[model samples]
Target: RAYRMTETRGIIHRRVQSIIFVLIATACFLAVSVLLVFAPLLGRLAEAHLEWIKPYMGTITIWRYIIASTVIVIGLFSVHIWLPAGKRRFVSIIPGIVFTLVAWLVGS
Candidate 1:
């Protein structure tokens, strides 16, 4: 049966790991969504309290892009490492992660 296959592959024994991964993924998704929802409000607050940064909005936007890209890379790397049935070395997965990010960037 399908259960036997999963058991043999050690997936059944990793219920806790799977749950943790799902929880973390959900948290990350919710965090991003909440950030998006409040971004305008936050921007207004920032502009009101920090007038000196108004002229540098372009530079701040570039930094935001860099930070967002870094978060995406880390999220992709975590998916590559944690979603599989067995252990994976970080170095072994870097190339695939990089390729995936590049493909995503190009596609977008």
Candidate 2:
């Protein structure tokens, strides 16, 4: 009984650690995405004097392009998981992909 309990405890600990890691990763990704999305506005605000923002200004444009592409890819993949599994369900993502591509092109 004691051995079983210890094994269960170990399994639980591993699961908890995995969940923590996923949560941290998710938070970091969200933070980066949010920052990239608002980077232009932030750059404008910091244009006058903020030295730190200057270095990132050029990189932010690249980040915006990468972030937008990442979002579109993720959205397309998500459609499979979100909808009932069927050949027709995959077709649903086409409109979303089209819209995303249009928005990304226009924004850039």
The candidate maximizing TM-score is 1
Give per-residue CA lDDT, model 1, range 5-105, as digits (tens): 23334556577778887888787766655454555477677889999868876676666566666667778888887666556677888888888978987
Q: Lowest-lDDT window of 10 residues in candidate 1?
A: 1-10
Clashing pairs in 1: none
Worst 10 residues of 2 by lDDT: 1-10
Query: Candidate 1 regions off by >4 Å?
Result: 1-13, 32-50
Give the backbone clash total of model 2: 0
Clashing pairs in 2: none
- Clash count list over all predictions: 0, 0
Q: Candidate 2, after superposition: displacement of residue 11 in Å?
A: 34
